[model samples]
Target: MLEEDANAGYRRLFDDDGLTFGAGFPLTGTNRSTPPIEEELRLASHAESVGFDGLWARDVPTYWPKFGDAGQTFDPWVWLSQVAAHTDEVALGTASIVLTLRHPIHVAKSAASIDRLSDGRLVLGVASGDRDPEFPAFDVDRNERGQQFRERFEAIQALWREEYPELEGEWGRLEGDLDIVPKPTAETIPMLPTGQARQSREWIAEHGDGWLFYHLPERTLEDYVADWRDDAGEKPYAMAIRVDLADDPTAEPEPMHLGYRAGVEWYRDYFRRLEEYGVDHVIVGLESEDPEEALSRFGDEIIEV
Candidate 1:
């Protein structure tokens, strides 16, 4: 069976027969700054009610002027745990968690706890991180991001899948005497590496349960899907796109950063093409004045139609 078929969280977000969609958090679509969250919990519940398959949270350890934005202005674990409480059934994803800044011990424990709390609904997206200032702030050498990312990933897997597994790495030692509590509801939680993750494509194909990538043009996406199929077979592939939806359903698509400002008619076509090209899931970050209405419009016009 495919990984998506095997893992509950993975299955929630991906299916072999057709594509699925997820709502990116900070669902209000505020960029380059923190957005208010008075309605976030309600919106999360609303998203699930409207047929979204997943809800994604981002990992932003600290705010930096250079950083694009504060991701939901909350820690991913706390936010997802809260989201898991208010909503059920939607896959709870980390858009990703920066491995270099966190110890795998913590990640493993948190993931296991959350998976058990949410009943195997956690799908982890791990990344090497791209912010320059965060490196020095965390006292980690920028040069060692890739190595740390790999080591932490392995450590987390060991903790998740094995009992008292022996391991020694830059993080610390697990000397075959101690164990992390709260293993996932499944055999192990799903781990999807985001972006290149400072690792080779072959490495990701070998280790990742799935891959989370940025938006790409249709021509590029087709080639990406083809390459992914060749390397990873049917392992699920998911991508993120920022959308500025228009009021008029018949309006044509106009290019925007990492996505399009298009009407619902064009929206339908784009999603169909994505599915045809073998993309498994699309994480849509909606940019709009009234995000709640946009969410309804997207669900009514694109997903339900």
Candidate 2:
């Protein structure tokens, strides 16, 4: 499908001029099994109301202690449905669903249903299983995640784009006699392969509707974008940034795992550089004592500027 065939969610991020931001999941900043669902929904509403472009959810089937992130402490489909019901205009997305651990038919149905429910506002970010424990929990082979991801992704695409596609894979087989119901609001849901997902860079560019990645250094990101252009041209490239904004608006960047602890001015200049590198969207995570206040500052100072 051409770029224009993408749903509203995809277009909101990629069809625009420069970069837009998405609020990351677990707004409460807890990795516990239970987070404040009502409050999180409240925060999610607050986020979109303040002009954040999208609401992102994560799919963590089972929380692994080693992973230390429960990813919103709810299912992506469920939480996003709640987000969709409460908000409008802003896109709804899965930071990623672990496809290797799910059947393609199920994923397709859930995606289509949510897409339809959200008024064509579902962007499905999919990934190979990575939490190690999840593979065994689902009786999946850890080593074969890459293959499973590729296969499931292909199956999902066919399921959406075709009426009765005949296919066979470890995930399942279709005889062309049955069909998955609730087709997407659009021709197909935009599928972004996240974190390499154990697939080659070439494969992702060739097959993915878009690409999702973790934070990279500025120089590294420049090289990555250069390579992405080689095959995918202007197809969107998105990433996650864990931010710890300093009180001083002029403080330079200080390193933190996948992002930075920097002043607002530094972030604005950084976003400009990212735009120059052809990075289309960023999933911004604010790590602060008061997430709501941080988001307020981000919307008023960082995103608005």
Instruction: Give the alpha carbon lDDT tens digit for every residue of 16-59 in model 2.
Output: 88799999988778757687888888888899878799888988
lDDT of 2 at 95: 84
lDDT of 1 by residue, 1-305 (tens): 26533456777877448788999999876645766666888899999999899999999898886766888888889888899999889999998999999989999999888888897889998899988999999999989988999999988998988999999999899789999998888878888999999998888988899889999889988998889888998888999999888888888999988999988899899899998888899999998888789899889888888
TM-score, candidate 2, is 0.97
Superposed Cα deviation of residue 132, candidate 1 (Å) = 0.4
User: Between which residue pairs do clashes occur in model 2?
Assistant: none
* Clash totals, every prediction: 0, 0
TM-score of each: 0.96, 0.97
Q: How close is candidate 1 to the true structure, as a TM-score?
A: 0.96
Clashes of 2: 0
